[model samples]
Target chain A: MSTQWIAVIGTCAFAFILKFVGHSLPEKWLAHPRIGRINALIPIVLLTALVTINSVTVKTKIVIDHRMAGLGVAIIALYFKLPFPVIVLGAAVGSAIAYHFSH
Target chain B: MSVKRDSFSLSFAVGAYGTAFGAASATAHFSILQTCLLSLLTFSGASQFAVIGVVGAGGSALSAIATASLLGTRNALYGIRMAPILKVKGFKRIVAAQLTIDESTAIATAQDNEKDQITGFWHTGFGVFIFWNIFTLLGALGAQAIGNPSAWGLDAAVPAAFIALVWPRLVDKKTRLIAVGAIALSLVLVPFTPAGLPIITTSLLAIVVGWRA
Candidate 1:
């Protein structure tokens, strides 16, 4: 009804359509070797991008900050082959300490 | 200890960010109803954030939709990745489509076997959906109280979870090289591009690697 509502509905619909279309693609198309190979790599690159963006940036500006400390701890935890929850906790605690001291 | 634990851990890591989103949407002047609708229907965290970020900055509704939709592109890509693996039809297809998201797809594909893959997909999808919605409500209601999510280092949780997800996949040198290149590509494009584009652009590196390989 309102502009905000309209935007919300429109965006939601568009997102759903995008998702549905991908799912609805022909099995033959998806079965192509190139498509399959490319799909396998999608998560790796995207997740890498996600990690970089979340750690280094505050909004649009790139700044080295406490999040990087969290990332460092996460890497070490991963290297040690810690459990998922522990690694997550280590990163959060690492960042929180750095954040408190910096601010 | 496999898909179940992985799904649960990944779900919580991803869902916890909903607090940040809830606080942000409320700060952007979205009514609780509007905020909840975005989480319920839109369901995608980054895209939802894009909507609030644009609108909160006094941008037009059209701009907000455009930006949010751009981020939602990744879900479509994930849907493509999951379709054959899921093999759902008719009504089930829609359900699967709705549940198709980053955490679900990531955990699903990360598993070794078909059973674990399916289990991971459904568990992570539903787990994240439940936790994300609940956290969104709490964040919206207590927007003022939450202050900065990053202060709790919740910001670190996302990337940490991402690292954990992708870490296992980088077993071979080729995949590892591609990951490194993507990280470099994304960082380079961050300042020059809009929020979501840099991430999307990294897919090019994957395509190139996949093509060459």
Candidate 2:
């Protein structure tokens, strides 16, 4: 199999194992406040990083482009507390317009 | 009855959003089959997105797996929350583990009574599974038919979706600060680090802040 396939399958297996381990292990293992605190921040940090990496960077270089405009529109939508789909659609529209003008 | 109704409505809404996932995965250059497999096998939104995002950005398989698994850590915590409430064993336990995700756990725990809790858990679990898979297929087919996903600015949708996912979670002052800090750290590291390393490195910030707090 190709490496992509391996990564895909490996990720799925890892996801399942993490969940299963939680079910099987003693609750006390993860019951610590410290663990909870760290866990709470993890997704926040990782996802914020994801938003940054996906939006502003292409490969190893950081370049200003339409994607930044898209992110800006998304932030506005969030500020207004719009629905999820609407926020995404607005960002896409904003970016598409910028992209059309740029090229 | 109320639990089932609530679960069904919530499930449909959540599942329909899988269309974005399907389209995003396709934009990330996943095959339709691969996209479906991600929905079927992985079945978690953020982690599945992280996989496609990393791999599509030219990260290695190891990096993809690490990022996806790290994002999935909360599901394990969800499983812990659901264990006593689920109280199953053997094959059933495995099945329960599979369904123990954010939506199901939240719905289950939200109910006032144990019966409603169990009912909410199973109904929402199965309902989301069915609808999410179906919508994922639909979205993949739609994205494929549209020719170039990027032309439609679907590339922008990926980060937009991440913003939407994380936005709600940034409920307080400290969380918002950490999120801003993470964004800054990632921006600084992007030029220097490999494709996926910047995101992974930001976890240290979380660890430090979380430990201190």
Chain B superposition TM-score per model: 0.70, 0.97
- The sequence of per-residue lDDT tens digits that candidate 1 reaches over residues A1-103 is 6656866887889888878988977656656777667767876777677677767765566879898999999999999999766887789789989999999
Report the error of model 1 at residue B52, Å.
8.5
List, residue by residue over B30-53, the lDDT tens digit for candidate 2: 889989998888889999888888
lDDT of 2 by residue, A1-103 (tens): 7657877899889999998988887777677998899999999998888888888888889878988878899999999999888888888888888888888
Error of 2 at B117 (Å): 0.8
Q: Top model by DockQ, which number?
A: 2
- Against the native complex, each candidate's DockQ, computed on alpha carbons, is 0.46, 0.77
lDDT per residue, candidate 1, B44-142, as tens digits?
876776666555534457766875676677687788878989999999899899889988998898888988899999999999999999988987887
Clashing pairs in 2: none
Ten-residue region with minimum lDDT total, candidate 1 chain B: B51-60
Best by lDDT: 2
- Tell me, by TM-score, which candidate is best: 2
At residue A22, candidate 2 shows an lDDT of: 81
